[model samples]
Target: MIAEENFSSCETPFLSISSRAILPHIHMLMKQAIPCFINYIHSENYKKKNLNEDDLTQIYIEQAQILIRKHNYPFNVNGQYRDITNLSKGFSDFYFFPNELGVSTNSIYSVESKRLPAPDKFREKEYVIGNNKNGGIERYKNQIHGKGLNECGLIGFVEKHNFKYWLDLINSWIEDLALSNRNWNEEERLLEIESHVDFCFLHSKAKREEKDIELHHFWIELGNGNSISNSKK
Candidate 1:
């Protein structure tokens, strides 16, 4: 079985206590990764209380650690990226619900993430593999990137290298789809999966022109609604 321990059980880690120090620099990072992020808000527990940007950032960071523990991927939680105009060196903009499976302990929650196309760039942005920023897995230094799953047993994707910005696209799709009158449940979950993959391909291609662009990739595993690993990444 695909268990969290299979990835994160380790002596050294991709992220350490020192990684927490990167929190102060996240504000600028969020801007570049998700231009619309400032307008969006998330609930602290979804049912408990409303959250501001600070609360959301903290949650993103905390859950990232849990996700790392579950996925056991090698990423410097405090790693930096340069020459990206919209993002900070080590910041992740908005992490979606499905992208946050590691944090949800309740069995009731479904896993999912969403992405939306930019309004002005929609035409130029091909949500296709060949034309979009995602040049495919073979082009990246890390193979498993921008892959996320949802609560309704659906899996979505983004490019691993450009995950921070791509997350914005995913959130936009989720928000729009959730608010639409269309019955998402009626369609096969595979439809959504295919849509996600397409979006990743297109978004990756669109951003390829950016000078010195980079993304911090995150992978989340939700097993029966709980994280399976004891060791935190």
Candidate 2:
């Protein structure tokens, strides 16, 4: 059973605009982009086994750009290192431009993608969320906070076989964070950013061949950032 304590009911103005205004644009983009990505991955003769996280990240970046162009959205995609402050340099996977135009103009939407491998017979089914290192949620926390990025979307890719398992595990992890008291500081940070982050999971049912892959996607918005109500969906 999931505990009620594992959720928050705080609503922020920035989060409200993101949920109401910007999210539809994002959803529309994903509707067109995911299929294009699947087609490209399968049509290309490249070796999927040889692609690393960086390689896959580039692919997502390309797909996002393609969709933006197709829709003629007035935004720029930036992948350069953005100086969050004097001491911290944050590099998001991509940054959309025209930061001053929109209901949430003050909020910047950054994209981050992670490729989680499908578990083999011996391992448990779950995604190890972090940066390059293991067990470092702080890295993402710091990035989001330091960059002052009010909105972020995390794209997660996994093999079709492990997709459902990964989704359940991710939800459990969120619930754990909501209920855990091990780190109040981290918990606070989670609460702070939960209003601004969206989690997306993508998978496909095609066989494991390098050229036979397809992609399916779904996303959930965390936190009680909506003005209508602050409830988890």
Candidate 3:
């Protein structure tokens, strides 16, 4: 059993999807919440400050907890959650712990967040593939994360440029890697689902070891507006 703690019972509107049978339902729900969180942070109307990856992750958790409690959702969002199944693999940025009735499970949906254009110039490729091979995509490709799960996610905090700009750049980088890296292929490029002025969502599939790992990519802009319009695609 995955740990069940800190959650209190509450009345909520029923959502149709079953927790154990449908992982995609959880994925969709989580994706839907991104714009909400983006708006949640912006709604505060505080003086704009440059927030790092961790800051954004924390904000996401806070917003998710609100929904979990309000809706009685079985899953929980955890930051820096370790994979107890693999003690040495290290913690993921966001672990959507799959649970039943608020009880945790071994099946974890891990997501690693990255900053587009990286905070430093020297680490420019860190969004697609990192210098130390810890790039958002590289981690799963190298078995650094999601070794057991067939799917994982990545979030790009677009500190610079638009979503299309980074998407093309990242796909180009992946195509370049496919030339020499046997594990990489052109098929791993992110394909767009939808986008707006403030957020973009895409999906990609990558080869990990002998199996295929699906990747869901979300990038949120933190530029001039920092808020999404016509929300929730």
Candidate 4:
């Protein structure tokens, strides 16, 4: 059972604590869900010879829902919430619904997923950085602001062999940001915001005639105040 003190009730939307406070719990939830996902993928019942991006995405979403139910999380699992004025969907993939029925963006958790096309090549910094724009990070950035969500969880799917290298690349990116921004103290601020973002990579070793299969997950802090754009400048 999750300790009461570890998580703040959805009622307190403007709670002053750093957003990072909830990350560990989210990580724990995802960690617990990963094994279930692997089992399902490898199960005899599963028979997708060539899993497309959408196929894998649906599996992840389903697994997340299962975990949420198993733990009796306070938040509702799935629904489409929209901003009538903007005519934009608040949570594209899924969101943690607050107790109140209304769409109070700040009170919920958001999740997004992306699949890596070439997992083996993803280890190279150039490949990861170049592909990021095409990989849907930009779309996620837009969703973050348009929805007014406090944070978003990003999931990446890749091949098993590429898992370690891909993770190393991400670490290098963070480290590089820190080194480059050392003079401006932006590193500390960026890392603090990064603390609120949780990343989880899930890889699969199933032999595919064409390509490798895997998945990764990340929880990103969103909204105007958390933008990393300014820090880059």
Candidate 5:
């Protein structure tokens, strides 16, 4: 782990090592910021109002930025940030950049967010593999999102099921897809790391013809007394 420097000098983190080498530390900051992010959004009266993925994500970033400043996380959040390397690749749902100096380097961590059990049938599989090639996991697999980074994030606004249910369900989708699709593979299934009352963390991998990358899955349960079905998990 890199030594924590005095980020008081600047807004971002200090990167004495390579950008890739410093990502693990940045990841830790995100893990700390996420729970607070979820709490802040729900406190804003999400259950009563209908907030789409983008609206919720923007809210998440807004509060996450506050935490970043309060705790001096040496990183900041940007919603719908464009690819610094290739604009043609389109926008990522969230981009985490170092406080200041590291932003110019390659320390960017790109993440895509999706709603679990999607709103409609046509986009039902979007959290894993979308019908329109816009799936959260699919983008990283195809290198359309996290093109150069070795690790990226998949943020799931779990609108229906619990984390345990989605953990099993998403893996089933990957297993089924691997059987027929040339690009999909069984190894891409998510492995649960830990589950809390507010959030769950999982890990997976994305492999393709060219290369593979590690994927960190974070699911935040937002349903209010509203499990379509019930499970203790």
Candidate 6:
């Protein structure tokens, strides 16, 4: 259960991925995420194992299954839930919902998961791979420009310096959806939404509603071409 207390620090313009239509895809993605993480981690230890790149990747993928099981959802280090709060005081690696829900029609709910503060001015941010070391990941934050929106009021993540691009893209998509006055199938709409959203803010799924319409869901994510980052960008 996502507690009320967890949503306090969410940034503005809430977006939510409903659990209805996207539950299956979300489950699949979550299942695969562990292996990906493991592969990334083991990539650094190849010399110790005397393994080649491909061999290390296979080992990492296999180990990822164990890692996922090791730390299931509501993941805790000690007793505390391991959420967005990493070393930084701000929420980075988890999701957020809005503090309030409006009673009016066409109300939009917000939910977001974000990484570190990758500033727009700086094309790259420093990621520490090990103790006292920093590595620069390539900048792939340009995908947020002019992304399309779905029936649900969800916007995809933008590149580091392109928040304005995502804003404009989402707003335009929403405007188009509104003008059409036609309901879109959630998955199709989300798929269509992909061409317009940024990989940086890749949304797994989403839903929004108001008094006039029933709640709905959309499934989505950024494609490989656009998804670049030190941490699964």
**Top-lDDT candidate index:** 5
lDDT of 5 by residue, 1-233 (tens): 99988966655545655557657766676677676666655564554455777776787778777777887765667888677665427678888876656346432788888877687777778888877688888888777898878788978878776888888888899999999987888888899888888888889989966778899987887756222222211
Task: Give the worst 10-residue stretch by lDDT in candidate 1.
Answer: 185-194
**Which wins on TM-score, candidate 1 or candidate 3?**
3
Give stretches of model 4 more than 4 Å off.
1-24, 79-91, 99-107, 118-134, 143-146, 170-233
Candidate 3 regions off by >4 Å?
A: 1-20, 43-46, 101-104, 225-233
| Best-matching candidate per TM-score | 5
Clashes of each: 25, 1, 1, 9, 3, 10
TM-score of each: 0.24, 0.54, 0.81, 0.52, 0.83, 0.23
Question: How well does model 4 score by local distance difference test?
Answer: 0.43
Q: Please list all clashing residue pairs in model 3, or write none if there are none.
A: 130-135
How do the candidates rank by TM-score, highest first?
5, 3, 2, 4, 1, 6
Q: What is the C-alpha RMSD of each candidate to the true structure, in Å?
A: 18.1, 17.9, 7.6, 14.5, 7.4, 19.1
lDDT of each: 0.26, 0.43, 0.73, 0.43, 0.75, 0.28
Q: Answer with 4 or 5, whichever has the higher lDDT.
A: 5
Reference-based lDDT, residue 71, model 6: 51
How close to the true structure is residue 196 of candidate 3, measured as C-alpha lDDT? 81
Which residue pairs in model 6 clash with each other? 14-110, 15-110, 15-111, 17-206, 105-211, 106-210, 141-159, 147-196, 148-196, 157-201
- Candidate 1's residue-wise lDDT over 1-233, tens digit each? 86655656544323332222432233223222231222222223242344332343444445545544565433313211121332222222233221132432111111112111211243212221213333221112111222221111111222133433544554454345436724211121111111121122211211211221122222221112211121111
Worst 10 residues of 3 by lDDT: 224-233
Indicate whether candidate 2 or candidate 5 has the larger TM-score.
5
lDDT of 6 by residue, 20-112 (tens): 333333334333543354344445443234322223223333443455456542111111112221221211122212223431112122112
State residue 148's C-alpha deviation in candidate 3, in Å. Answer: 0.8
Error of 5 at 188 (Å): 0.9
Residue 97's lDDT in candidate 4 = 47
Identify the runs in model 2 with alpha carbons over 4 angstroms from their true place: 1-20, 47-49, 84-89, 99-107, 118-140, 143-146, 175-233
Q: What digit string (tens of lDDT, one per residue) describes model 3 on residues 75-183?
A: 7677786777765365688777654553445546788888776777778788778777778888888767887777788888776688989989999999999998887
